[model samples]
Target: MHDKYASVVKILHSEASDLMSLAILSGRDPFRFYNGADLTSLDLTNQNLTGLNFDGADLRFAHLEGASFDKGSLNRSVLDAAQLHLKDGFEFNYQDVLQFPGKEILMFCMIRSSLIDEILIDFGINYSVFAEFSKISTGALRKARVGKVIAIETAQLIFNGVFRFSKTLDSKIGMKCINSIEQPCAKMLVGGNNKPFVEISAEDVHRLFEIRRRRIAHMKRERGTNASPYVDYRDTAEYLMFYKHLVDDIDFWTKFDEESA
Candidate 1:
């Protein structure tokens, strides 16, 4: 199977824009076939690319709009300015709560749990890779994994590490559109007049991260030598909501540049 996929990749590389190579991958797991392939500027428009694994693929400027990739993995793939179909809306719920213990320790547990690791997995990347890009350090990442109450700076570091670092060209363009334009872009609009709902800049995310850190510190201090700190549910809820929106905003913006173009 591996050899077959390797052969397919060789063919794909030779015929960079060949639909026949893609047709050969129809109804099959295209992960191995396209992984690490130089698919730059490929015209994948309206293709059924469901569940394709594009890890390490250089898809810069690829046309991906109208394509379906509901289960595809673009992990660590370069998609500079690649057009993609954006999601209609964002969804968040308790199911996304990572693990148990409920809202009180949601944020901490999210950090402690496999959240970042899971994200890295989707990106076909590892903690060390994220550390190198995020500059948060492996030790600090480990501490975060252990659910330690990280400092405010570290919190911002983690946020930047996940979202800001290693951004594709489209991500940068989308963010610029959001920041520069006063009019509502994409689904980021609100009311009938299409006013901007919110502008969650890197600074805004950092502020939320700081607020979350301060709340954790305050809760720990209040506990005061008794035992473990009780994470406040309300505080966690507040930050988590913003965190969800921030994620949605990023996702939307990544696809937003194409619409503006």
Candidate 2:
């Protein structure tokens, strides 16, 4: 019986190692190998079966005491009359988050509570300027601040606004800055095909004005302009991009917690 159990375990590992690894990393299914396998009355005692996928497998009257497995190894597997021992400390199920009935609202709230302010502060932008530039309605912004769920269309508008504003800023700065230099040139980059002059767009002046507002806000807190992160001339001249989005909120948040820990 012991020899038979070892052979079965070896064969399963050989066939499904990659899939099991993927499932563990992604919090997804890894049961392709044992989707419908029968291992009735088998002795798997004291075995190390961590991260294995045993979905749809039969384990009736199997001796599984002291066998080690990850939180999700036996998901969807049958365990009628089987001796089992499950360890603790398996909290925060990604599946539960996915199955949540109010997940959409939760996502919207998260964005409104954190992402909007984060983007604005990172860009040194004021609420009014951001609203005007992003074309986000004042009402919608107010609703978002109070934790009210905004429409999907409004959320999309905010995202597009961030993307477009970043791109426009990049274009303006790129035309002004010289190669390998942080500051913009004195003259605009246009006209004769000689040495390129920096093209200071109207947007540049507006950004500088916004930076001044940011500096003023900092000064009110007794931090002063010197304490501001965006006080340098390069701050207005430099271009930054925002190119990423949250595709899997659960996965993203989980990774965030792990890294912070």
Candidate 3:
């Protein structure tokens, strides 16, 4: 069993229409209506996310190991590189089509989908408040994915705001069942190695925000000419490792223990 972070996901879709105006009015883009989800590096480790639509989403590099969900959840999604296992004790690793070695060098690299959900769900956040921050155009990130390549900063604001813009809800019947039983969710992130990582703090999330805000502000002031000192960019491997460590630390081996028992 695993923590799907599904309750947190409810924050993004709970009451989208009421807050659309504020979401549209804030930050850089002032008039876009969208509320669809695109996730990569999402840790759906042992939660039920049945029937969730992830069309046009980049689910590359997600940690789905030991997680259970209907296949329908990933409808029309891009799963270029993902770690998964439908059964207990199975280590699933998938490689993507991206990142070929260049110039006679033998190397391979991949990426997470870069959605806001992917970045924060692992922090054990209860996003009930963000659901009401503003109504979101869930389709905005998909638009950015298909229409124009968005700046990393813009994507951060979009995904982060979408969640903060959401409100948490009562757990679904299935989620309640899982919680009531105290079924421990797998603590590992999607990667080659299965290990528990570290626990994240509120400061870490806020730190990410402050860095992005300052960078975005500076980009606006300088007209997208230079990089911000505060923003620490993680390459694909590093990004995966950060999650791997974080996910690994959270009840990391519980699933394996269950399987071996």
Q: Could you arrange the candidates by TM-score from highest to lowest? A: 1, 2, 3
- Please give, for residues 126-203, the per-residue lDDT of candidate 3 as tens digits: 333333332334454444324233333333344335333232433343332222111111111212224322322223
**What ranges in model 3 sit over 4 Å off?**
1-36, 82-261
- lDDT tens digits by residue: candidate 2, 104-158: 1111211224445545655577778877876888778656545355543454455
C-alpha RMSD (angstroms) for model 3: 20.3
TM-score of each: 0.32, 0.26, 0.20
As a whole number from 0 to 100, the lDDT of residue 33 in candidate 3 is 19
TM-score of 1: 0.32
Query: Total clashing residue pairs per candidate?
Result: 1, 6, 28
> What's model 1's lDDT at 13?
62
Q: Please identify which of the two predictions, 1 or 2, would achieve the higher TM-score against the true structure.
A: 1
RMSD values for the candidates in order, in angstroms, are 17.9, 24.3, 20.3
Best by lDDT: 1
Worst 10 residues of 2 by lDDT: 178-187
Model 1 collision count: 1
